[model samples]
Target: MQDEDFLRRPAAPQPYSLTPAILYLSSDAVHATHKLLQRAGRNESCVFWYGERHGDNASVHSIRAPVQRSRRGNYHVEPESMSEMVRDLRAAWRPLAQIHSHPGVEVEHSRYDDAMVSSRRILSIVFPYYGRPIANWPSDIGVHEWQLNYWHMLSSADAMARVRLREFADVEVRDFR
Candidate 1:
């Protein structure tokens, strides 16, 4: 029920690194996506820490903008926003990996979603929230299970960084964990 619980829970420890300025997701990282989705609805952005090596230093990456409520009744990150995101990532010299929500259901990429994801030379993270209660959750920590799925891209180290810079403009870094 709290972020502390997540921190203390016995789950696979995904390797990560935190900068005084940003958090990083190392390769082999995994965690719950459900909580993230819920937070996104509140217009809060989240990032992932990815490292190239299995348990090496990871970087914090965030998602910008809101997930559009689709006309077909699904949530989606708008293409225009995605384009801007890619541009921003290129500017930052990071790869594209977006964190989005699935409120209370299974989060999986649709065919359309895949098509969009495939167009980029980055990673895609589909976080699905299963409607767990976190009212008593800590502001700094959270826990959930994330299934591993990815697209292969030749990189210097088999990893990429997807950062959400918009968060820095709105909230303090402490609010992100």
Candidate 2:
């Protein structure tokens, strides 16, 4: 929705603005993420996006696959593993989103997913079919953000706008699995 429309709403204005947050990702980063997740086969997998955020826009330059336990249904990343994954990363790079894979088409957040996410401030994206390409990346995929008391899943259109995929070089992928 436009800024004017958002302001015209009847309810009390939210503490946060409705201005959409944009995540800039390169095609290389997207491919690396899929490869990392697809390695888990029928199990769930996760890769964290770390990058530079300026205002409401961020550019994902690194994809880290932390050492985590994975199963057919879920995955878990330990605190120590997370610490190790980013030990050498630059201080300025921030966690942009947590991307994971689901075995099936269902990409909604489970209760476990809600609790396991490293940060509510970042986006939680779930890729379907064990990270295989599913009806174009980021569209059918689950892209949720923390809103109010829950993780609100954005619509396909919103998801596409929120994550802009571009052709670029120099997307680094770190696999600590």
Clashes within 3 Å, all models in order: 24, 0
**What's model 2's TM-score?**
0.87
Q: Please, what is the TM-score per model?
A: 0.37, 0.87
TM-score, prediction 1: 0.37
Model 1 segments more than 4 A misplaced: 1-23, 26-36, 39-58, 70-73, 83-90, 103-105, 118-120, 130-177
User: What tens-digit string does per-residue lDDT give for candidate 2 at 59-106?
Assistant: 998899999988887788889999999998888899999999887787
lDDT (tens digit, per residue) of candidate 1 on 32-110: 3334445445332334322222233224433333334332124445556545434433233343344443333333444
Per-residue error for 69 in candidate 1, Å, reads 3.9
